[model samples]
Target: MTNHAAGSIPDAANTLVSENGYYGAYGGSFIPEILVPAFAEISRHFEEIRHDGDFWQRYCALLANYSGRPTPLTYADRLTAHFDRAKIYIKREDLNHTGAHKLNNALGQALLAKRMGKTRIIAETGAGQHGVATATVAAKLGLSATIYMGREDMERQYANVFWMKRLGAEVVGVDYGSQTLKDAINETLRDWVSSFETTHYVLGTASGAHPFPAIVAFFQSIIGVETKDQILQAAGRLPDRVYACVGGGSNALGVFQAFFPHDEVGLVGVEAGGQGRDSSNHAARIAYGEGKPGVAQGYRTMFLQNSDGQMKDTYSIAAGLDYVGVSPILADLSEKGRVRFAAATDAEVVEALQLVMKTEGLIPALESTHAFAGAFQDIAESSKSDIFIINMSGRGDKDIFNIAEGLQDEEWKGFIKRKNSQFEDQSR
Candidate 1:
């Protein structure tokens, strides 16, 4: 976690994980033998389609026409004024359809599934945005969809579950283990072991096994492509730093791709600090030594685990960032020092969420608020001329319930109670 000497780490350009799958010994396919052929098939198809101009043409068209491409890079005037230091700009991924950058990968993967002759889609989600996005795309493509979500996450993010079901996808609640993202992932992979013939498991983030990390990063790189052009256009130069919240690392990798070639631009990834770094409940993998190198969820990476190598519990105010392990790419980057990592406590995240909403009039998702919290920490030391770009990964609409419960908003709870009572009375 300390600063490393120049030349000690691999060049960022060369460190990008490619088709071979291993990111400096961090990623590999460790799945069941039955799924090996299916993974190989996916890898081969991805390799071909990634190079096919016509395939990309179709994917890009959907991004532009359906999911809304070129999300804004808005300069935060009030936040700049408040900080009185570096300039602040937000890469407004929250403005995209489905209210997050998840849609970009969803549409791309769903298209790939169709081309591969897949008739059904199976996906796992934590905060449910990925489920909603997958469901939305499945509906558009006329494919049957099933979303696996942890019982706890589904409860906190029921709005997304509602939308997923409304989109005609089947939602299954997994109550095993922690009943959260990790459990959802476990169930989804279990389902994939048997259903890979006709179903494409749209692995939501740049985690999991070999082809998935590569596939997800490939689809997500569009965010960086847009951010690079938008930031250069808006700021007249590359930003001094790029900040993004890191859960499964798709969003951070999405924004980090364009900046990788610009070695001068610093990259920072913020992990969810559930209670505080000092407490045992948080998920600050790098900053707090909460995670160690371990294999879980089909890949080898940093995971919250015990000395016996059993997965440990993790907590985060935002369900999306509550996972036990991170993307192998992120783990490699953290080790190489190509990207520095930070932690935002649950308190800091809430405060940043309120502050951003008040200052910039933007209601960012709770997961994205962690980035704001991390970037805000640098404002005091940053030069006035310095530029910073924060990835607002999603909107806050689906997070209303989670935020209300976290804040213990009695009035909101009372309203929910009354609504439930009314519905119960009518039903009786």
Candidate 2:
């Protein structure tokens, strides 16, 4: 590993990508042969644009004009009393144009695609939010767009599917493997390998190879910048706790960026607990196992893989938060104990969703619910002298129908039948 001064992350950060394109042994492209040139080109061009004022000027202009940036930092009034320890605040990235923090990075990469003179964009999406965001930008930029989604998710996230279609993008549903994010990524990679000459692959998270992880983080760091300023403006001081949900970990990393240098801010990442960590079903990677370096989904990172190196089955009620491996940088941070990681059960996420909608009049995406669940813990444990902030990563409109549908699954049939039988006998 190349050495740099501790805490002095390179100002021109992309230049610091190591020989293997690592951010301290957490990132690298371990892809097939066909993707080398494309990834290398992305890395090289990304480095060139590291400090390009003109590029940023245009980017900033778009954010102002189109995306409504400098998203609000809102206080969660009802949660404050219940948590009792700290004032709870939120960085309302959920209110972004595309409804999640994914757009911040997607738009940034889409801008880069324009700079690269690419005419088409391809992306792999889970929960379909990233695909929708990518397709939205590609439409706005008048570029051709294609999004690959897991076949199962295509059904579960039908609203996002409709959004991508409305934005004039072709959605290819992949049925391979587990029919999930990993499979969608495999399909997108196949397309990238074949069409790299003219297509830009817009990865949605900060977990890919070297340049991608760095680039996505840089773009999404707007969350941190805005949050820091907004929190100070609203609360007159820094928040004591900050929370964000982790999938491939972009949103968490984005929000965590501004606070990394602050020892006082307690950074927490809420991983998906499909059932529970101890149960067979869970997406709780960090809590369940030691995160060793391994390759999956084109980047080498910390994943819950079996002894044979195959990835383990991941489970989460939130499709967007169901990835088996987390971003390598997050793994590093957790390993160093710089950040605290926690798990939130699906039941807890649903409860948090209900609480936010009823009290805050906002419906948060299920993926983001993990943050609220964890922040609730911080709020509950605190003594009302502290402040907690949760990154409300997206609106929950897309998840409402799916979440409701899941509640009516075959598993509930027995309960339904017993309740109906009791009611019928009572009437007789």
| Best-fitting candidate, scored by lDDT | 1
Candidate 1 Cα errors over 4 Å, as ranges: 1-15
Give per-residue CA lDDT, model 1, range 36-115, as digits (tens).
98998898898788667778767777777777777888999999999999999999999889999999889989999998
In terms of TM-score, which candidate is strongest? 1
Clash list (residue pairs), candidate 1: none
lDDT of 2 at 242: 90
In candidate 2, what are the lDDT values of residues 234-324, reduced to their tens digit? 8899988899999888899888888887899989999998788777677788865644568877787888777889887677888887777
Regions of candidate 2 where Cα sits further than 4 Å from its true position: 1-19, 406-428
Per-candidate Cα lDDT values, in order, are: 0.88, 0.81
- Lowest lDDT 10-residue stretch of candidate 2: 1-10
TM-score of each: 0.95, 0.90
